[model samples]
Target: MNIHAAILWEQGAPLSVEEAELEGPRAGEVLIEVKAAGVCRSDLHPARGDWPTRTPLVLGHEGAGIVREVGEG
Candidate 1:
């Protein structure tokens, strides 16, 4: 699935809203339709280069959303 997300492609760079490809809700997983999302301090650490985080990272793990799909458990 295609979705919009806050992505950090590099360190010390501001996050950009980009088109991202999302895989299925694999076994024991659920797909969420994010209604609200927030970029917390931990997410900033990677953007600010405070931590050696991998590039092309997705921020905003903190979010409130409804479960749209679920995979077989």
Candidate 2:
């Protein structure tokens, strides 16, 4: 699936809004159609280079969404 994501390509850099490809859920997983999302203090730690993090990271874990698909348990 194609979706829009906020990616931190580098430390201390602004997040880049880009198109991302997502695979279907695997075992014991579910795919959600995110309706709302939020970024908190923790989410900024890595973004601001206050903490170590890998590049090309997707942000915003706090979210509200509807389950779109479920994988085998």
Minimal lDDT window, size 10, model 1 = 38-47
Steric clash pairs (candidate 2): none
For each candidate in the order shown, give its overall lDDT on alpha carbons. Answer: 0.90, 0.95
Cα displacement (angstroms), candidate 2, residue 14, comes to: 0.8
Error of 1 at 5 (Å): 0.7
Off by over 4 Å in 2: none
Which candidate achieves the best TM-score against the true structure? 2
Clashes of each: 0, 0
**Leading candidate by lDDT:** 2
State the lDDT of candidate 2 residue by residue for 7-31, as single tens digits.
Answer: 9999999999999999999999999
RMSD of 2: 0.8
